[model samples]
Target: MKLYDVIVAGATGMVGRKMIQVLEERKFPVGKLFPMASSHSVGKRVVFNGKEWTVQELNEENIKNSHAKIALFSAGASVSRHFAPICAKYDITVIDNSSAWRMDPSIPLVVPEVNREKIFSGSKIIANPNCSTIQMVVVLKPLHDKYKIKRVVVSTYQSVTGAGQKGHDQLMKEWNEEEIQEMKFPHQISFNAIPHIDEFLDNGYTKEEMKMINETKKIMGDNSIQVSPTCVRIPTIGGHCESVNIEFEKPFELSDVREILSKAPGVVVQDKPLEKIYPMPIWAHDKDEAFVGRIRRDETVKNGLNLWIVSDNIRKGAATNAVQIAEEFIKGK
Candidate 1:
């Protein structure tokens, strides 16, 4: 077996740390792991594959010196915007978990289960879609293939972990009745829900919401499919859950819907209303598969179906997805 030298940018971040863990859990063929972060995080220790690795500073010189073949970036958009091109210039395939490159015409916004073929061996920069978008699209892809989706309405109850460790720390501090040292969110998150995820756009949709709307079209490979999303940050740590209502061009039976989703890749059907079982974040945390439940019909609209989707925001939504893209690249190679 051949191992590849892998660099994980933003190694100290929530998603970055999860990336390392996922790599180990999935037994990715990593020969040398270069965990790179900012200067302040330099020399920090991170455990990967049962071994502690010192974090390296992310700079032009460090990146150029590492000679890594693949770079998984969970750094901020600005960091990714600056460093991803450099990695590409070095012939390193970059799978980025940031909004900086998702909308770029050249960069492939990939959900391996949805459109793995979009990523070819020569593809340099691959963008991981927003956390909410990833779980939803994994469920949407198969249904759209059979029913031909027309539009989708999604309302997300996202976990604070999606915001990063600061968001998680803030929630813990507030729950402990401690002084609020820093605010990662606009308001208090304990027992509260904020209908805002990212910066509000001029059109009233947030950057997070728009990412879902547009990225859905791109990943599903359909411009005609419309998406209306309302992303909210709630006080939870398990995962992010979404209430997705989809309108299809053709009619479908509930049994067929259930069977199709059960057979879909990267999706798990947990819909059993009478038995009082459904998909929830508590069960989704740490899991890679997207869980779908609460399957029913939206009688008001023509050929409308409703679904509840849940998945760990950090795992499947960011780290696992990025790693899957890298897996696809290696398979093609």
Candidate 2:
């Protein structure tokens, strides 16, 4: 098997850690793995594939000197904005898990199962959509192909884990009978839901909410498809759930929708409402497949459908998607 050199920036982050795990789990043809972090994590050891790999501090010089041909970046957007170009300059193809370049016309904002054919080996940078956007778009792509999605109104029950390790810590701290720590979220996360995920914009939509709207359009390749989103930070640990109402340009049968979703790559349809079978974060946790359920026609509107979608935010949303992009790059070679 051929091997490729790779680097994972933000290796200490929740999504970054999972990126490494996915690389190992999928056994991507990695010859060398450079684990990168901020200065604070320099020299720290991270165990991968049962071996201790020392973490290296991310600096422009190190990034330029590294022989990594592919780099998966999950550091915040600022870090990505500052360093991603530097890596790109050295001919490294970056699969970024941040919103930094998703909107860039030059960058291919990709979800492997949806727009993967757009990916090319010559593509220097690829943007992974938001976790909420990733699963919803995966479930929507097949339906859109069959019925032509006209618009989407989605309400996300996003997990605290979407916020990162700090979000997870906040929930655990609250769950452990401790006083509220105002770190991960603005309000109490345990036994409560916060309507806000990211900073609020003038339009009253949080950054997280807007990402869903914009990223969905980009991923689905349908700028005419309008998306209104309500992103909430829920207390769940692993998965994110979405209540999506879609209006199709063409009519769709409920049974046909379920069959299409069941056959869609990276999707698992679990709609058996009679037996209380539906997608839940608890059941979807740690899984790579997006779970869709509650397939029903919206009685209020013509050519309208409603569905419930769930997926492990950290896996399919972040790590696995990035890994899939890497796999796409490998296959191209």
Best by lDDT: 1
Candidate 2 global TM-score: 0.97
lDDT of 1 by residue, 230-290 (tens): 9999999999999999999999999999999999999999988899899999999999999
TM-score for each model: 0.98, 0.97
Q: Give the Cα-based TM-score of candidate 1 against the true structure.
A: 0.98
RMSD of 2: 1.2
Query: Model 2's lDDT to the true fold?
Result: 0.90
Q: Lowest summed lDDT over 10 consecutive residues: which window, candidate 1?
A: 115-124
Angstrom error at residue 102, model 1: 0.3
Task: Give the per-residue lDDT digits (tens) of candidate 2, residues 22-96.
Answer: 999998988888999999999988777888888999988888777889999999899999989989898889999
